[model samples]
Every structure is written in C-alpha cells, then in structure tokens.
Target: MAINLAILGATGAVGQELLRLLEARALPLGELRLLASPRSAGRQLQFRGETRTVQAVSPESFEGIDVAIFSAGGGTSREWAPIAASKGACVIDNSSAWRMDPEVPLVVPECNLEAGRARPKGIIANPNCSTIQMVVALKPLHDAAGVKRVVVATYQAISGAGARAIEAFQEQCRAAANGEAVDPGPLKGQLAQNLLMHWSVDEASGYQEEELKMVHETRKILGDESIQVSPTAVRVPVLHAHSESLTIELGRPMDAAEARTLLAAAPGITLVDDFAAGAYPTPLTAAGTDPVYVGRIREDVGNPGGLQMWVVSDNLRKGAALNAVQIAEGLFA
Candidate 1:
C-alpha cells in the first residue's frame, strides 16, 4: 500500500525543499497533502506536475495521513503534531518542540533508526539540522573509536532561518554591489557581508537556541550521556548549506588515516579531502546536495586523541526535510 503523506509548512524554505526531494525521490505516495498556515491556505504548489492547493493545518488534517513530515516551526508542531499522531499518523517533526521529550525519540536514521521505532508517542523528532549532519559523519568513528568529547563551530546559511532570511541576505548583497544602503530587517543586522556569532533565538543561558539544540541533540542521537558537546553557532552570509568545523576527542587513540577510512565507509557521508587539488567541501558545493560532506581530516595539534574535520550539508535537505523523509521511508521499508 502506498503511504498517504502530509507536508506541514508547505510554503516555507524547508517545506519547499521537502517538496523537491519528494519529487526527486519519487516517494510512493497514494495521496499527497500540502498543509500550511492560514495565511498560506488556498495557495497553489506544483508537485509531480500536479497543482495542489495548500490547506490550513488543523486537527482534522491528519484523518487519513499515514505519515506527516513537519517542517513548520516549533509552535505549529507543538500544537498539531500530537493531534496528527492521535489520528493514527506517524509524525516526523523537524522542530525543537518535542526533541528533548522522553516520549519522542530524537533520530538521525544513520545513527538511531531503532530509536525512531521505539517512540511510544507516535512522534519522532528530527535532530537539529547542524546536529544531524555532524552525527552522521561522527557516528561511525564514535562506534569504532569511542568519541569522548566534541567541539563544533558552525557556519550556518541564512536559509536556515527562512526564505525571508535568504531574501534579506540577497537584497543586502545586491544593495552593497550597487552602492546603496541596505536595511537588515528580518535578520536584525547586515547579513550579506558580515558574520554573526549568534545563530538562532538567544536564550537566557547566553547560548543561542540553535547551539543548545546541537549540544543536547547530539548527545541524544548518540545515546551517550557522558559525551561532552560544546557548540558555537554562527550565521554566515551563504544562501544554503551549513558547514561545521569539528574537533573530536576519542576514548581510544586513532590517527587521521584511520578516521578517514572509517568515515568513508559510513553511510550518507562524502569525503572531499584533497587539499592539494583545492578540493574541499564548501557551502556552495554542499547546496542542494543530500549527503553530508566531510573534509580536512587531520589530527588536532593540541590534543593527542583529538581529530579535526570539516562537515558541510544543505541545512534544508539532510538537516531538515530530507532527513525527515528518510525516517519516514525507513518506517515504510
């Protein structure tokens, strides 16, 4: 039987990418439901050459949905995801709403597919976009070498915020090129030519919520309560793709070549580590790609057991929509 699917946040950045992936992957769907906020209701979207009108999300929206992929913000997921699950739909939520909830299993299929099935709430939480890619690249090594600590600094894309944020970055760039004063409205400051250390909503703890999500989500996905994760999330001017510079200290000694070998054999990871050819993973290269790119694999000079590497991925795809879809596919398979 073909799965009946519903896509929440159908008009947003991640939502749009979800639509593109669904088309590219040609998921077996008996019926596709596009759902959005009230403001986006009645709008038409093209899916597989068919025009489908988006409906306002509500409790009744999940009546026949076998699986619901939520790219909507946390508020929307908090309000509607449980309702969808109650209506017998399995919800793959791409929001912070239920990620830390004990009942909702936070998953990166590459690392924790079994945990996804262990969810009693019928809701599976997708890890933060940054966390997802890092874990995918790190899991194989962690299993082989036993990762003890992780330090990650992210160079996130503007699209991680939303389409409006992407537009804001573009407008700022165009204005700069034309020698005009650019207003940074949605982003709160100039995003095109500047980098901001703050990535997401700032919490009272001084760490932006995105960074905190990474620290917590990584631990959850790895099932390692003792693994220490320190994160610094930064918003770069890039339109798509998030890149991370990671340094990991393992419980056992492992050299760069061994780490590279382990990472190469891992699923959903691509090694782009030929610095001699000026070949390394960049945001521009990672944009629109589904796999996580790992490069600059080497030993950390300061720490004997530490390995440093670069990880890049399209935040909208593997980080959010595509990962959620993959989880749903895992369930179906």
Candidate 2:
C-alpha cells in the first residue's frame, strides 16, 4: 500500500536525511512533496533517481498527504503540525514542541511504537536527539531490571547543532590548525579542539535545556515519571555522532554479564563490549550508522551494585531522521 508523503523543512539537514532514508528503506511510496520555508522554495533535491524541487510550506501542503514528517524547528512545528493533522495526515514531528504534550505521543519505535497509535492531537513527536539514543540503550535493561535512576554525561557532536554549526566547526578547526584566531558561528564559543555546555540554560534549575530534555523525556518515554535522571550535556569537537557515559541504578541486582545477555538480544542495539581487548563503541564507529552501539558494560564500582556503559549513535541518523522514519514505517508500513 503506497502512501503519499510530505516532508516539511525539506532543505534542512534532518529533512534531507529523511529523503535519503525514504529511498533506502521499505516505505511504499505514492506522491512525495518537498516543502520548506519560502527562502528554500526553488531549491531542488535528488530522490529516487529524480530531481524534486522543494516547495514553500503552506496550508495546502498537507492536502492528500498521508504522513507529514516535520523536521523544521519547534516554532514551525507548533504552527503547522495541527494544520497538517487537520488535513488528515499523520504528522511525525522532530522537535521539542510536542514531546511533552499529553495529547501527542513521543515515540521511539523500538521502545514505544504502540503509544503512537493513540495520538489525540494526531501528532507524534520525535524525542530530543540525545534522549532518543539514551532511551533506546536503556529500554532493554529497563524492561529487564527496572531502571530506577540514571546519571548520564553526554559528549555531543557539533552536527547535533545543525548543518551550519558543522561548517563553523570545520572553519574553526582550519583556523586553529593554521594558528589563527577562531570564530564561533551558531555556537557560543570555539568548538574546534574545545568542549562546551552551550545549550540554553534555565537559570533557576541550573541545567542546560539539552540536559533537562534527557531528564523529562526519559521519564516520559520509559512511561515512568518516578524514574530519576541526572544529566550533564557537553558539546565536543567531533563532527558526527553523540556519545554518553551512563551510570544506571536498577531495581534488581544485575551484573554486567546478565545485562550484556539482555542487550545482545534487544532490538536496534549492537554490542561491542570486549573490554579486555580495549574495544568499545565510539563516535567515529557510530557515524552514518543506524543502530545504537553499546559497550563497556560493567558494574559501577562506586555504587557497588549499579551498572555503567558507554553508548554512541549518529545524532542525525538514529537520533533524529532515522527515528522519525522508523516511526512512520511502524505506523504506515
């Protein structure tokens, strides 16, 4: 059964990845519409061996569309998601706008695809990129041992910021290599050979918005509001993929071997946990990949009975575009 599809923010980074996944994945396709802001209206994108010109988004863009994937910013999603839903399209929005809305289901297909089926607002949200990968890695253990608390420190990539941030980082790197002064564009400070906690901060909570997303979004996706999440999100100089060091406390006492067995059999996870050989998942290993890579599964020495691990995934792929496409696949295909 072929379905008509519309991609909002078609000229943006995640939107372009959505186009590539649509071509590579098994989504029965009908008519495809590429939409963006008026500035990107005339630009052409290549898909399925044909050139598709992007059109400016408007009320009529959702007409006859079955599933609309919104990769634009939250403002655009807040404005257009309901409009798209009203026109009978199931909207999968990748933004912070609707994830916390009780009416909208925040979905990571592997973890909560069924929650997506009962969307009261007809909008399904893609979780924060950082949250998406963390939840995916935690789901299997969570189900097996009941996750009680998580302390996560994220090393996020510049690509997670946006396409422009990537260019800025590259330029900064070049400048640094030449012993020249650096310019931080779309970033607070130099990201080349540097680290930053650059996400918007809530002065009251003293937590960056990115870190807070992990806190609330984790509870929501795991369907346990009582679960505790302590997060610290930092930006690294990496070009792609986000990495996290997680210290998890579970309900029951589970050793590293037991956790490894469960994760090895879980969906959307690839284990590279040969610690003796110094093998562990890393940003470079996960870039351009779809699966959440987990390694260094060990009992937390400090906590005595808790678990620790390293997780990594491409922020743009599994973290954003690929996750949205997977939700659409589960719902429509």
Give me candidate 2's TM-score against the actual structure.
0.98
Residue 5 local lDDT, model 1:
94
What do the candidate models score in CA lDDT, each in turn? 0.90, 0.93
**How high is the lDDT of residue 316 in model 2?**
88
Q: List the residue pairs that clash in candidate 1.
A: none
**Candidate of highest lDDT:** 2
Off by over 4 Å in 2: none
The ten-residue window of minimal lDDT in model 2 covers: 11-20
Per-residue CA lDDT of candidate 2, range 224-300, in tens? 99899999999998988999999999998889999999999999999999989989999998998899999999999
Model 1 agreement with the true structure over 1-333: per-residue lDDT tens digits = 699999999999999999999898856888899999999999999988999999998888899999999988889898998899999999999989999999999988899988888879889999989999999998999999788889999999899888888887888999988989989778888877789865566667888888888888888899988888898898898889999999999999889999999999999999999977898999998999899999999999989868999999999999999899899888874
For model 1, what is the alpha-carbon lDDT of residue 120?
A: 90
